[model samples]
Target: MNTISSALWPWLALAGLGAFHGLNPAMGWLFVAALGLHRRSRGLVLMALVPIALGHALAVGAVLLAVIVFGTVVDATFLGRGAGIILIVWAMTHLLTGHRTPLRIGMQTGLAGLALWSFMMASAHGAGFMLIPALLSLCVTPGTGVELAASPSVPISFAALAVHTGAMMAVIGGVSLIVYDQGLAFLRRGWINLDILWSLALAGGGIFLLAG
Candidate 1:
């Protein structure tokens, strides 16, 4: 029915955004996958993903809450710029220090570790900022646009979190599987070290946002 279709739009939009999040290497899933590959344990790798996803969701959720509360007063551009600067600083620090391999997923990532990893990765990448424009665009317009911004009503916030988390897990899991199955022969021989490439990509994205 038209009613059902209309109601489903926002959720679908959030799902699309979730997929978009998966597409980005800087989202931390790649690092999670790399950690998994290093450990040679799929379960451990997948476990590490939980905290990373939670952290990303929490970061975005906080931003969404701020937007909801201050929609009338906050300057979105300024907030975005501030986030960009923060990300640039984070990237610069990493670049200066060099990329260290992430810890393997295991019992080590307790609740505290989960919270810390999630917050650090999410904030460092400005993952929350990406949701702001998308959310505002959706809430301000109706039909497809509105559905894209928010759907399932206020509950859409949770749904967005689920979508993003699920998508990232799936991507990391798939990558881990492939890497494990393929073994390190090709990886070692290949000129491209995906880990380095991913790190540089993160740095480049941060720099681009800061300069823009």
Candidate 2:
């Protein structure tokens, strides 16, 4: 039991990180809130969250899957460095083009389009890469790069993904409700462009991975 509990810590941390990501406006909650307000229907916001969460899951799952499969074969240091480079490059591109040449999708865009947008946005932000360290620690032996590829645990991976997705969806739902009912009036007054902050965060995570 103690052993199992210890191993679960990284998954808990992933959920915490998912909650943090959910708090970010760039993560799709703000857009959901806006959609709800525009349509004057809270149902729209509720419906929107499904695709949003799916997109996010896809983004995170891609990186997590890669790390799980390849991190076993490659040296930990090498794998970490490669992920770091990908993240840093992603951040740089986001900073350069995200706001300047933002992708515009109409509010009337269907759920599929919304999902596509969310997927692109989350991928660009390197949201999956942000979870790599935790994933590595959970899926691989610490300091020893020994791969657990032979003993792939479906339950553990499913649990981690489910927890992370649940956390993100919960926050997005809660925040969207508040914003839909109360308005983001306060945010306009103290508006912070969170895109830059998110970019910096991606860069920071990349640096940490590289340093480790």
- Residue-wise C-alpha lDDT for candidate 1, range 1-212, written one tens digit per residue: 98787566555655655665565555555555566676667776667766767777787788776655554344544444454565556556666775443633453346457556667655655566555544543444332211222233256556566775677667756655565567646346652434344445445544544453
How much lDDT does each candidate structure score? 0.56, 0.79
* TM-score of each predicted structure versus truth: 0.57, 0.84
After superposing candidate 1, which stretches have Cα over 4 Å from the reference? 1-13, 72-115, 142-153, 184-212
In terms of lDDT, the best-performing candidate is 2
Judging by TM-score against the true structure, name the best candidate.
2
TM-score for candidate 1, please give it. Answer: 0.57
Residue-pair clashes, model 2: 0
Report the CA-based lDDT of candidate 2 relative to the real structure. Answer: 0.79
Residue-wise C-alpha lDDT for candidate 2, range 59-83, written one tens digit per residue = 8887777776776577777888888
